[model samples]
Target: MLNMRTKAVWGLLALALSAGSVQAAEPEVTDARLSLLPGDSPGAGYFNITNTSDEPLTLVGAESAAFHMTEMHVSTTENDMARMESVEKVDVAPGESFAFAPKGYHLMFMHRAEPLEQGDEVDVLLHFENQPELPVTFTVVAPGSM
Candidate 1:
């Protein structure tokens, strides 16, 4: 009986340790939307990513079936001129949030793979370093809305 109790206690301790090592929560994405341009022009995507995990994560890029190419970019005004440059990655610390808004860090979706219109929904997969790809749905909106 003593040996059996000891084994049970050890088993419970292992189980507790495993649970503690598990990630508490996955990252949360909110306010996902896309600014769809008219005709065959490229569009832009915006959203907010909240890092709920215990460690920092890097957002590398994004992919979507609606677009053939997707890249991370940042828009800035330099010397009275607007400039848009490609960004390699963005880091979000634990318990922090990152925004992909207008004139800020955003996803540049180019080369449409399919037809899209306003009010349509598209699936986008956000790639991260050292973490699983996060799936987000973006609603198409007018370019002027944004």
Candidate 2:
């Protein structure tokens, strides 16, 4: 009986340790918004994501039913000219945060499937490397609001 008790204790301890080692908090997203342009122009998405987990996270891309194609982009200036370039991935270290804002890292939502108006809510699924996709709700706003 004593031997059985010792084995059970050891098993419980191992289980607890494993659980503690692998435990991580979910990533937090805030201020998610999508700026829509008139006509067939591509929309822009902005948000702030905080990595609350124990490991690093990489943002790969995004998808939304409102748009046919969503891509990650970064805006920069060179020789007094503004330039926007596509980015494949963005890494955020543990306890760090990344912002998708105007004039910086942002999402380019192209080819709208349907007409969207101001105050409408858009559902965007953010893809990450080695992590499950994160669903975020973005409120549509006018381009001038950004």
Candidate 3:
């Protein structure tokens, strides 16, 4: 027979386990790639971010050892001229996926430490507002490969 205190502790343990399971189902990144441009030019990165939890997820920033700075950018066309702008954060709804592709939302890697070659792999750490920092590997590909 379990005492009242023992029973309460067991109940709390069960609740903690349930909460852990819920946290495990969060946002994730997949199909990540970085474009390799010629010379010392800046490159773009593309990926798909999926939200699996019940609430929305916001991607705040990103960092990489290969570049001096990483920023989220979106391309827009005004009067037939395409331009890119930096964004502070990207919001993703539950059960939805955000695409970072060409002519759309993407990551701008600025001031690279060294020029990235084809088939090179780079590690990028993605920061979120409500979740832990996600470590992602981006494969370097030729320009315009998408």
Candidate 4:
């Protein structure tokens, strides 16, 4: 036996709480950077992605305004030789973090439209399998700095 006004108030409160929880469950990206070479060579990007929610997060692809193509790659050494391979997706477990570093998981930026110099910033968008597109800015750094 609840009044109409009381029911409306309760409904609004529930909606607000749900919205807050959704925001809190989103993943976080940090320490993003793009390595700049001296010439028109392909650059690499690194970052740390942290999943804060209970569910796993999957990154399917990435896009950048400075390059024609962005791809995920991983470096491995076999028989004393190092090689890189393209990766389709990367997964992060709940409450865990995925690191993109030198000689590890990284993003390959190819076919650059313009030259990138040190201290420049590039805007990149990360596509997720289940989450919304996350926008990130990567600072251009030297090749050896990781």
Which candidate number would show the highest lDDT if scored against the true structure?
A: 2
- Which digits, one per residue and each the tens of the lDDT, describe model 3 over residues 2-50? 6988999999999999988765465778999999788878889999999
> Of the pair 1 and 2, which is ahead by TM-score?
1
Name model 2 segments beyond 4 Å from true. Answer: 1-23
lDDT of each: 0.93, 0.94, 0.91, 0.93
Off by over 4 Å in 3: 1-9, 12-24
- Candidate 1, which segments miss by more than 4 Å at Cα? 1-5, 12-17
For candidate 3, what is the lDDT? 0.91
Let me know the TM-score candidate 2 reaches against the reference structure.
0.89
What's the true lDDT of residue 51 in model 2? 98
Tell me the tens digit of each residue's lDDT in model 4 across 1-146.
46988999999999999988765477899999999787878999999999998988999999998999999999999999999999999999999999999999999999998878999999999999988899999999999786
Which number leads on TM-score?
1
Estimate the TM-score for candidate 1: 0.90
The model with the greater lDDT, 3 or 4, is 4
Better of 3 and 4 by TM-score: 3
What is candidate 1's local distance difference test score?
A: 0.93
TM-score of candidate 4 versus the correct structure, residues matched by position: 0.86
TM-score of each: 0.90, 0.89, 0.88, 0.86
Ranking by TM-score: 1, 2, 3, 4
Error of 1 at 79 (Å): 1.1
Model 1 over residues 22-135: C-alpha lDDT tens digits? 864788999999998788898989999999988988899899998999999999999999999999999999999999999999999999989999999999999998888989
User: Candidate 3's error at 99, in angstroms?
Assistant: 0.3
